[model samples]
Target: MATDPIEQFQISNWIPIEIGGLDFSFSNASAFMVVTAVSASAFLYLTTSSRGLVPGRLQSISEMTYEFIASMLREAAGSKGMRFFPLVFSLFVFILVANLLGVFPYFFTVTSHIIVTFALALLVVGTVIIYGFYKHGFGFLKLFVPEGVPGALVPLVVAIEIVSFLSRPVSLSVRLFANMLAGHITLKVFAGFVTTLSAFGLAGAAGAVLPLAMTIAITALEVLVAFLQAYVFAVLTCMYLNDAVNPSH
Candidate 1:
């Protein structure tokens, strides 16, 4: 029987590798997270180790990545957003690396899991809440009130806006997770068609080629999707931060 490609996404079981009745087994997701962090560190180290005026290829790529995030922040969140350049840039690179790295053979996509994405989303939303409250005091509550609305309707309007504000993290996280999950599953399903069709005759062989082609094409597209997904995640973060810093926007 053929394996279900979707089942390949399962999180590894917790083993009883116990220390004083506490179970801790290295999971596939955890391994990927470690790998993602190490890979990011190594990339940064190698790229910046030579502080020469003349640029190297790796250094150029790293610089470009940083500038890209900076540009996005300035464009989306404005000059006030520069204060967050470091955080936004780091986030963009980290997520980009984790996503692109998962495309390799025998590797897991940490971002495909809801737990990981939701955690990240929570951090973004949490930062917004904390920063907004600290910066604006009780005026942060005014985020839910539109400027042009009548005082009579303010209560009902605020209630709706509050729900919308709370939904940001879920919507943000689910967007990335759902896209990555769907992309990988679609790739796997197309690849599987090649296997199933090859068992038939020449027409089957002929037909099998199409799915193989599609799989290859989608793989390339998924690479683009990976980058775009990372971009989307970072941009949304900037937008959320903007709403925090300048809540009236």
Candidate 2:
């Protein structure tokens, strides 16, 4: 049977089960998220526990991943911001794993779904807001107010700051979802071309070769995109944390 590429994106279904008198339906995206969380935890536990002085290959790789995230956080949020290394590291690895999982031939890439990405974005952005308020109390409200604003322009600048802050999740989620969706769609379309061309005569078969080659190239590019989108997500989280730590004005 021919697969519906559009249908592949569907994530919801009604389940009869109820929890606390509330109906709950399991979703494909939800399953993927659970899998991502478990796999990430198990991976870290297994790799970190088998420690070596110099480090085994797996230990080295896992430590490298940890250092990569720690270094990125330090770079963005600084040493003072280093307190968030655990949060930032988990964010980076979870996202990187989720993104790469989608590149496999049949697995649904949860990150390609806007809702999943949006949820993650909201969590990160929400963390920044909550922590900012917790650490600074009412003074965190000053984040939306530029100190040097003239009396006449203070209201306008504050409004702009609030709007920008609210838009963070929208921008962050859309970037990952859009990039993954577009890359996968383009890849599927090219693969379809290879299929259609193979049915024609020898001349048509010859033309099929180039599309197949392009498909291979696109697959490699998609792998890079997977890694980059994860990096971008982690970095943006760090930037937001920085803003919470020290308001620009």
Candidate 3:
């Protein structure tokens, strides 16, 4: 029998815990998330610890990643937005590492879950809103009310802007979650096809070639997607931060 493609995403509790009738069990998802965070932090720390005069391969990688995100944030939000460098950098590293880790066999994809991605989206949007209000005071409301709008159309434009702003989190979370989930499922299905077909005989094994090829292709594509999705998330985050910093625009 072919393995179920969806089985890969099933969350299993590793260490069950309950407090005040709440299920707070440590799960496979939790474990991988911890692994992702620790691995990314350790990689960055170890790679950059020496700060060699002439950069080694590891140090070069670390430097490149830093510069990439730094340049991206600077471009998206401007120099003033560099104030949130730590937040934006951390998010990029975390999501990038988590997505890459999920590519490994038996590893749980943390961002594939809607809840996980949603929580991350909420964090970004929440930061934008809180900082927008704090720094700009009521001036942040200008984000929804653009300059040079005629009096009659002002209400309509404001309503549209408000809806679009509110929908950011939903769109952001769903983009990441859906992409990761669909890619993994497709990979799993093709892989299962290869395995099931190979078991029959010489003829079956020959037929398995197509699915095997597809599985390999999808795996490579998924790796690219892992990085792409991370970049997309970080880029959107910077753009949103720009709104907070310069609400009038």
Candidate 4:
């Protein structure tokens, strides 16, 4: 039987374990997350280990990635925000690699799941909230009050601001999750058509050509989307952190 296209995304337990009525199975999704992290680390390590005077291609890529995040942080969060360089950079690299990995034949796309993306979004927002309160104390509350609002409108504006602030995680997480899920599903559907059509005789083989072309095109587009989604996530993270760093704005 031909494999179901959606079955590619089904999570399977590689090592099942239950403790105190809690299932803590080591799943394929979890495995791929580890793979993504390890691959990213290895890439960074190997690319920068030499530190040659004339940078190799890998070194140049590593350096460019560093500068890109640095520049993004500086622009969004300012000089003091550079303190969170490690945090932002790691998030960027991890998401970017995880996305890129999913482009491969058998890799799982972690960010395609709402739970994973929401957790990441929560991390970003949680960090901002914690740092904001810790750094600015009561002053962090000013984030909800606009500078030019009249006293009469302050209450209404503050309420609106609070709702908008709370929605950040939802927006951020859904954007990434929806994009990855849609892109992958579309690719799988087209690829499956190619396989299904090719199973017939000569006419079927000929019919598979269109879907094959679409599959290739979508594959290339997904690669760009993977990078774009990662960038969007990282940039928004920086912008949120900036609010924590400078809450008055």
lDDT of 2 by residue, 2-56 (tens): 3345655666753456799885767667787778889888888898896778888
**Compared to the true structure, candidate 3 yields what TM-score?**
0.98
Global CA lDDT of candidate 2, please? Answer: 0.84
Candidate number with the higher lDDT (3 or 4):
3
Q: Which candidate ranks first by lDDT, i.e. highest? A: 3
Which regions of candidate 3 are displaced past 4 Å?
Answer: none
By the lDDT metric, which is better: model 2 or model 4? Answer: 4
lDDT of each: 0.86, 0.84, 0.94, 0.93
Candidate 4, which segments miss by more than 4 Å at Cα? 1-3
lDDT at residue 78 of model 4 (Cα atoms): 96
Candidate 3: tens digits of C-alpha lDDT, residues 19-68: 99999999999999999999999999999999899999999998998999
lDDT of 1 at 151: 85
Candidate 3: which pairs clash? none
TM-score to native of every candidate shown: 0.91, 0.89, 0.98, 0.97
What lDDT is reached at residue 129 by model 2?
Answer: 89
The alpha-carbon lDDT assigned to residue 89 of candidate 4 equals: 98
How many backbone clashes can be found in candidate 2? 0
Model 3 deviation from the true structure expressed as Cα RMSD, one decimal place? 1.0
Model 4 TM-score is: 0.97
Every model: Cα RMSD to truth: 2.2, 2.4, 1.0, 1.2
